[model samples]
Target: MDAFLFQVLAGLATGGIYASLALALVMIYQATHLVNFAQGEMAMFTTYIAWSLINAGMPYWPAFLLTVGFAFVLGVLIERIIIRPVEDAPVLAVVVVFIALLVILNSTAGWIYTYTIKSFPSPFPKEPLFGIRYMSAHEIGAICVTLVVLSLLYAFFRFTPLGLAMRAAAQNAQSSRLVGIRVGWMLALGWGLAAAVGAVAGMMVAPIVYLDPNMMGGILLYAFAAALLGGIDSPMGAVIGGFAVGVLENVLGAFVIGNELKLTVALVLIIGVLLVRPSGIFGKVHVTRV
Candidate 1:
């Protein structure tokens, strides 16, 4: 029971990372029908920026804020300059463009950062939280932070005016445009917001995983599984799915498959979900009239 409790706590901590990224994925998917394949790479790029700031004497919190801001602007620019042109194109075309972006960002980060792994510092102290035997301060702190972020996001989309506009725009751009909503700007805003969220995930996970240009690749896979498991279009589902995947991965990896086959676990879950319920656990199925 003690061992089981420890794994559960550890899973929650690791799941916070997936939840953050999955939230980002849900945000973009909500606004645009296409998924941004470059989302992880974009997060990696901003994390590198944060690292540079910290290395240059900036405080960790300040560096984190600046990196998030930078990521938002970069996301907006990418949407305007790159994605906008392809917005009306076929889905395959947009996906290819996103793939191009993924390759470019990955190569750029590797070139700039030299493909070296570095240690990242946690803002939280390296002690147990409130003397809890099952979890460290960093683990508890990270899980709390992820929950807070998700709550704020829920409030934003549920109560804010801009959030309403964004929702309106996503549901029907033609109708939104006819009603005088700036659909393009709303889409750009979604990208910016998603980028900021991804930046947060990158910062949170870096300390545990170590920092590198390619650190997010495997993490992204888990996040993808979480998003798909919960319902790609639901942020709440994403968070729940993240935690579920995290715990499932921890238990299965430790007891059944071993750590070496953990990636296969994610793959199996994704395939199983798709085969059993393509709309996902919480996703709504829409029927169209011919």
Candidate 2:
């Protein structure tokens, strides 16, 4: 029982990581109806920036804030300089651009930092949380942080004017523009916000997986699955899906398949869910009355 309980707790901790990244994916999807294939690469680049600051003697929290800020600016620039031009282009063109961006970021990171992995410090203590041994302090703290972020995001979108504007722009650009909202800038702001959130995911997961140029590659896949599972259009669903997938991974990895086959498990879970419910569990099917 103890072992099973520990696995569940561990799953929640890892789930927090997935929830963060999945939230970023959902944010972009909500605004643009498109996925940023390079989201993980962008996160990797920003994490490297944080690493540099930390190495240069900056404290963890300050470096983390700076990295998130840098990521926001970078995201806005990319949207304006690259995405805005192709906003009305074919889907293939946008995908190709994302691919190109991914390649460029990956190559630049390799050239600048090499393929080596670095250790990241966790702000939480090394000991157990609240003196319990079921989970480590860092893991609990990270989960708490993820939940807090999700709550804040919910409040922002529900109670804040800017959030409502962003939602309006995403739902109907022409309508939003007719009502005096800057649709394009709202999209750009969404990109910046997604980037900032991705940076947080990167920073939080770095302490566990260690920091590497490709650290977020597999994580991105899992996040995609989580987003799809939770209803990509719904932020609340995405977070719940993340925790579900994380728990599934841990439990399955330990009980049924070896840890080596966990990725395959996630893939199967995605396929199975999609086959059963094309709209995802929480996703609603839209009907257009012509």
The lDDT leader among the candidates is: 1
Clashing pairs in 1: none
For each candidate, the alpha-carbon lDDT, in order, equals: 0.89, 0.88
How do the predictions measure up, each by TM-score?
0.97, 0.96
> Which tens-of-lDDT digit does each residue in 1-290 have in candidate 2?
88888888888888888888888988998898888889998998998999999999999889988999999999899999989888889999999999999999999998999998889889888878677999998889889888877888888888999999999999998999999999999999999988988888888888999988888888888888888889888888889989988888888888888799988987887787778865676878757799
Worst 10 residues of 2 by lDDT: 277-286
Q: Count the backbone clashes (under 3 Å) in each candidate.
A: 0, 0
Model 2, 270: alpha-carbon shift in Å?
2.4
- Residues 175-203, candidate 1, lDDT per residue (tens digit)? 99999999999999999999999998898
- Itemize residue pairs with steric clashes in candidate 2: none
Q: Highest TM-score: which candidate? A: 1
Please give the lDDT score at residue 244 for candidate 2. Answer: 88
RMSD of each: 1.1, 1.4
